[model samples]
Target: MKPLVMRIVFWSVLVAALAILAGVVYEQYGRYRAARDFPAPGKMVDIGGGRRIQLDCRGAGSPTVVFEDGLSIDGSLSWAAVQPAVAQRTRACSYSRAGLMWSDASNAPRSAKQVAQDLREALMRAGERGPFVLVGQSLGGLYATTFTRYFGSEVAGLVLVDPSHPDQVARVAAFMTETRSLRSRIAVSLAWTGLLRAAAPSLLPQAPNQTEHDAQAVRAFAPKSMVTQMAEGDATDAVLAEAGAFRDLGSRPLVVLTAMAPYTGSELRGMQITPEQGVQVQAIWEKMHEEMAAWSSRSAHRLLPKAGHDIQFDDPRAVVEAVLSVVEAVRAEGGTPPG
Candidate 1:
């Protein structure tokens, strides 16, 4: 009986190992195929050290507008709804940061300072000359703010959509302890190992009107993308610290879009928290947005009662109008339009 039990256990372990190996192989092949077939829709510009970043630009006008993504979002896809409309009036561009989407992964630290520097270099290489109007969503707000500090003269305006405040981590630490909880860690581990992708691909966010090409791209890079995003999240404090080094924007035209719906605990997936805690989170969030709006003397803090965190998806028109306002303001300030 003992010998038979040992054999059963050994065979079970072997089968499990083989299944995991197969999943890894399948995921790797899918990634390779996606990279070859769906390639970047825009140009790939070398940033240095043989690493390239993907950039997509549209329209023609001066004081070009550059869109930056929130945490984990592909820059190109996130701005799909707003970019076209903005492009109609002025040059609008978006690019994938290193390690996300088609951009080459970098060994550099995933902090805001490094990201800002890479973006500056990519812009110069891509010939998207600025004095740019920088539009940043969520965590991209941190990067945009850092960029202004590093290259103040090149930025003509700023627009933040549900921007992440530097003080956010500390502000909500009590309720957001789950960020470092065991369950969170396990989820990330599964993602890194491709188990999540194999078991439940739909758990990942899908782009609107997702095509077969887009699906392939997501399947191919989801694991790497999650890793990159996690790294960035881990480095949030460092990024916020770097952001503290910048001087306030004296009178730069700025627009801060704040989502009106308060958190109701429903947004936290797979995590349990009280409704009261959720209300507290929402209050802190709104306060942070308000504080960010105060960064510029000419800033406008617009509360979108109907929109959620993803204002671009929920209300593309609002984003377009906010950007248009900034562009018009910049032009009125006598900034030259791109030829």
Candidate 2:
């Protein structure tokens, strides 16, 4: 009976639908444009089964240093500050896991063991020879250890940068493996809708030292990052437990770096961590890194009080020193890295 009102409602719904469709189209176009602007910086090696991994290597030397990135971050981007320095001393490689930027997604689960195999395969196929020095940070630490466990002969040394302990699930049950937050969920939704890429700032305030190209690439590929990060959250508990299965590194020289800074208000906000809980978590984290240092008889536990969790970004010197130190130890052990 209310034809006029019904017509208005119908038109409103049509207009809204049209607007959303237009935004979606625009977002796709933007992603294509960004990819063109910042293409893959390294070689995309096929790891069989129609899937490929991005492996970017630099410098020239032996005992190749391979970097494993922390949760959700682009592998190479995380090492922007540290890798170049390490590369100057020896060969350095950074790679993206499946579903991450430039790497083809896989149907396989994102477990530590799986990631290790994927890496080994990629390196082997790409002819990136080993007697490799593995450097891992945060979640990457687990994958690095697992890789060594499965392929010990090739791994000559290890440098763990604020690495996550395998037992962290029990130590900090509240937030150890739970990475999904209210903010992340919101970001994921926005990313899929293309709103995130659209709303991204012209400059990345997070990493001021980054180049303009890097900043633009971050904004463009952020949507893919959000989804991959969420998938990784699902595998955290499994990777932790799996990596914990190996405890001893025998005589392999190990260096465990721990950042002593407590969680800031901003960081705590992102993790939804309370101030009191942050203190407890911090204490537990330090102890975990200490225990990891004992994995090798020749291990050193270096504590950087001024640095935060992302020590590479905050203190590139510390990371560079640790990695180069491990490389020196490996050379002292008399292992020649095959190229």
Candidate 3:
């Protein structure tokens, strides 16, 4: 009886090993196929050290609208809703930081300063010169601000969407560590194993047309990108602090868009946020947004009543109009046109 049980256990272990191996190989093959099918849409611009960052620019005119995505989100993909529309009015460029879909991974730790430098170099190399109207969402706001600080003369306008406050980590460290940071780290780790592939829905679900839908075929499960995203998430404290240093935007046409909608029941539960905590979070977020608006003397704080955190996807028209308004305002000023 003992020998029989031992043989059974050995076989069980062997079978499990085979299954995991098969899953890994299968997922890798799928990734190779996806890459072949959906190559990066834009040019891969070299940003020093022979490392490349993807820059997808559309339409024409000035000042050029440059997009920076949230920390964990796809840089160009997340701007699906608003880019094309804004492109129609003036040139719009969506750029992926190092280690995103088409961008090369960076050996150095992720920081707002590095992102700002990388973008500045890439734009100059790509000949996508300023004056740029920078549009940043979530953590991208930090990168955008850092860029403006380093090259304020080149920036014509700014739009921050539900931006991350420098003090946000300090304000809700416990909540972020307990809920978002842990969950995100785990999810990103699982992505490499193809575990999150099943849950990888359309990067932009509210995509109006099939073209936009098909364009978002890239997956977020690449090992390099996953590591990069986790690194950025981990370094939020430093990034936010770096962004906080440059508060004064002078007279740039700044528009701060805040998502004021209540979190859905599922979202609340997912974040493990209690009703009281939810209220507190909203108040803190709005207060921080107001303070960010005050950074620019010519800034306006616009509240989105129905939009959620991803205002671009939730209210594309609103985002488009906001971007166009800023672009038109800058152009009206007769700023130096892109060379």
What's the true lDDT of residue 288 in model 3?
93
TM-score list, all predictions = 0.89, 0.93, 0.89
- Model 2 sits at a Cα RMSD from the real structure of 2.6
Worst 10 residues of 2 by lDDT: 202-211
Query: If ranked by lDDT, best first, what sequence of candidates would result?
Result: 2, 1, 3
Model 1 TM-score? 0.89
Query: Superposing all C-alpha atoms, what RMSD in Å does each candidate have to the true structure?
Result: 3.1, 2.6, 3.2
Best by TM-score: 2
Query: Taking the tens digit of each residue's C-alpha lDDT, what string does model 2 give over 1-339?
Result: 699999999999999888888888888988798678878877999999999998999998899999998885465777888889899999999988887777888898678888999999999998999899999999898788899898888998899999989888777776544555677578677675677777667323556356666666767777776578787887788888888999878788789999888778888886678888888888888898889998888899999988898888888899899999999989986964221
Per candidate, the number of residue pairs that clash is 3, 0, 0
Among all windows of ten consecutive residues in candidate 3, which has the lowest summed lDDT? 202-211
The runs of at least 3 residues in candidate 1 whose Cα sits more than 4 Å from the true structure, single-residue gaps closed, are 1-10, 173-178, 190-193, 205-216, 268-273, 336-339
Higher lDDT: candidate 1 or 3?
Answer: 1
Q: Against the correct fold, how does model 3 do in TM-score?
A: 0.89
